[model samples]
Target: MVTIEYIVDLVNKHNVWRGKECINLVASENVMSPLAKRLYVSDFMHRYNEHFEKSHYQGTKYCMEIEGFVKRIFGERFNTDKVEPRPLSGGQANLIVLAALTSPGDTIISVGLTSGAHVSHTKFGVVGVLRLEEKVAVNNEDLTIDVDATARLIREKNPKVIILGRSLVLFPEPIKELREEIGWDIPILYDVAHVFGLIYAGKFQEPFEDGADIITTSTHKTFPGPQGGMIIAKKDFPDKLWEKIYYTTFPGLVYNHHIHRLPALVVTALEMNAYGEEYATQIIKNAKKLAEELYDRGLKVLCADRGFTETHQILVDVRDYGGGAKVAEILEDNNIIVTKVALPWDTPKDATENPSGIRIGVQEMTRYGMKEEHMVTLAEFFDRILNRRENVRREVTVFRKNFQKVHYCFNNI
Candidate 1:
């Protein structure tokens, strides 16, 4: 058997190397603050809490306190009525929301995976519970969600729950119109995993105002917290609904919940409360600038004709470069990191084998202090490699050294 200690040591080495080199452009990744990282690796690593403290856990007074703080931070940041901070991951949080709102075999309507919807919302992930029976996509021209298409699908299929959100949102979701079409009886689940920070900062769509029944998100994405999840409901919430989360989470599903991540998340939320708006704005600006620069450098960014993006992420079609995976590989060779993604209209097989798009985002690099000028320079680096210019490695190394000298890493500060 592989020894756990060796694995742990290897992971530590990998973290160190990952920290020092490479520009992380993957949409779902973020660098935690040193304070947050410390909390995750400390006593919190050894201890586990299983109950809500009012129930079965043995030593959970302090755990509940931290968890309470975490929930309060989320409540204040998002202006939601209540927040539950105990889900193990965003996917888990989404699963809990699905379980709470719908029963087995209930139909769920969501964006298809090619349209940037996460697996958790589909039959592939939560089908054992959610039973996703309908999915919609966006208009090919602007890559925006097709509200009319969604309305027609809902009218035809009549799903029990309608989920409006995405893994690669470039603009505000069409929540206001969708709710109006579906009426108030159906549960509208907003999976705001990618845009939670942007939403807090007043840059994304307002889910509550538009009538979403429940909101689920990952704390790490734009919220800039440690890796964990949250589920929020509007005020005047029912106790039975909350009970679903509590029961499913405790004995039904997850155990050994990380109590320490909550405190760190609380700290991160406080930081978000202070700088969330400006950070979100800067992140969007950088995203647009990067996408535009890349397009100008002969890359094909989705929605380039409609303004690269309003959010931090932009999808570039890399089909000309042997598809997204090949483009991602070439970029990785030059110290940049991005992920392969399927276009909203691509098939599942295309997504798995030869997806046509690359997902890039500005959140992490923005947190690292890069701006539009850096985006232009980064785009030039891509040009060097893609256009097959001479001395590509040496040129990129010099450019990266200059960028690093700006002291972008949080620890360097």
Candidate 2:
């Protein structure tokens, strides 16, 4: 007896429960601004626009204008004139870039899942889909890519492309060092999906100046835009490479490009231009504060020697408390959301069933105006739930109620 009303009720329930009651700590998610959310649902959603240039469909002049404006804003913000805001997700962006940069059977180097690489970077996902060979880069003691080892591997293997960036990124990658080792002839693509907001706000390293030939990211995550993907390249990158990317994105991949999200993405880009620095600074501070407080509370927070994190994420080894999956479930039951994650030492099997780690991101909470003190309180919640075996769901709901309003955007609109 399924009906439209039942579906609507389910949607409403989620909107209230997840939106209003829980403290979201998912690293790969974010809340759009009120204005951005409103603009996200528009006439464009019902229409279609094909190709990057003039659309093949009629009544798309305004869509064309918004797309161009979005591209221009990203270009100005990132200090590059070549920007593509069309891919549907970060995974798709990676796919487009890979299709453009390498052929089937070509070898590419990227971080492995155990070392915090996203699945899209591995043989299990798009790399496999494209029939490319994925070679994992070595990791140091602190879970960062081992620059010297990676350089040696590049020399020995002669990979078609080197991909940098991580899902559990804590410190900035050695993009400059790796580039120096490999020389300027090789292409290095940095997938900044996880740290997009931090980079946009200048709180994280600038990949382009650090020798990344191309940068790809999803517009959501820390960027706080509606769900979509974007790619930007250095102005001096080979024109042929750019052409390959363009063609792969259009005829080779997407057909419509989801025009409705353009306006909201533009609004988010503008908001970042206005309030990005302050917001990014707060997010990093909150992540550090939360990590420190969790460590002080006797939790095994990762990279304490490196000040917890330079970006919005924090990782903790939760295996001591019945493993990551169990701990994540317990935390979610208490209205604290986090994802079970594989640490550097985890095997492929452990990464799926019972990982040894939990990943937390403070960007969304920071966007909701949570400060260092709030981070301290949040860490206390984790302590109560994990260490003391307390049910703090009611308390967490009350605490989250005060943070429902989104910050760092033009709220008055």
Candidate 3:
């Protein structure tokens, strides 16, 4: 009995409420630039282009051209020609890589779920889908991967691939040290999904330079593009390996790869090439400031001794404040958006319900022109909501009203 008008109104209501009133701290989401958003809705969305150059249908010359342009831009930025932008999501990117590199029943090493690994790297995701054996690397007291223990595991396990990177990443992974420990033969796949912008801006570790054989990432998280994934390999990677990736990506994984985002992604890459450094630098600063402020307000912020974080994300343990889910709900009611997450101490079972942590990212807010001082105000807002049990939704909405315009983009003056 629902009408189209109702659906349209609901969509419009959500856009205004979330897009305008909320202080979005969700780490996995971002807003595309005006130019990119405009180009996102195009004729390419309705067309079909298949298998890189081999189109399944006609009238795809422009789509092919834009895709090539996107590839070239990513190549130039990342310093590699072996770049693929076709995988539908970051999970699919991981699948394509696993299909290319490992066989069924082959063992692989990755960070465990409670230790910040994306689900795609776990046994329940692409690894299980491909029938691969999953081995977990140990984490240190400070939440970073224990390289020595991981080295021992690598020696004993003889894993087919070693996956680096994490969802709750605070500092750069010890890629160079791990490479030295594991030697050069085994392939190392670094998922740069969370810190793609920092990597691109030269504000974070360069995985390729540190001997990562391949890198997989989504363009949206920190990169501020459309929701899509990309894969890039080192220049010295064997052509045979790239062939495997190509076959896996085309015939093995995606049939009609999303093409509409190419033009939009290109626009975003151009914006990154222009303004990424400043944007990334501010994001890190804001994250650090926010973490420090929250910690100072008596919250158990992780990695405080390590300067809180070197990327956009900040992790806070909220178990004392009614656990993650409750606190996240209360914050959402106050126009603040964050996600409840599992801390390293939680087991997989507890991680699903009543988890101990909340994750906040400042990249989107930074894009909305929030600075370190604004982070202080945000911390006070958190304190008011969680500690004082006060309803500050009106104040939060008023505060957010000043930050509607996007920064670090071509359109913004």
Scored against the true structure, residue 265 in model 1 reaches a CA lDDT of 81
What is the C-alpha lDDT profile of model 3 across 68-126, one tens digit per residue? 89889888877888998999988899999998999999999999888999998999889
Off by over 4 Å in 1: 1-9, 53-55, 128-132, 137-141, 389-413
Tell me model 3's lDDT, rounded to 2 decimals.
0.92
In model 1, what are the clashing residue pairs, if there are any? 114-344, 115-344
Error of 3 at 243 (Å): 0.6
| Native-referenced Cα lDDT, model 1 | 0.76
C-alpha RMSD of each candidate structure in angstroms = 2.9, 0.8, 1.0
In angstroms, the error of model 2 at 183 is 0.8
Better of 1 and 3 by TM-score: 3
Candidate 3, run of 10 with poorest lDDT: 48-57
Predicted candidate 1 versus true structure: per-residue lDDT over 127-146, tens digit per residue? 44465455554443455567
Residue range with the least summed lDDT across 10 consecutive positions in model 2: 48-57
lDDT of 3 at 299: 92
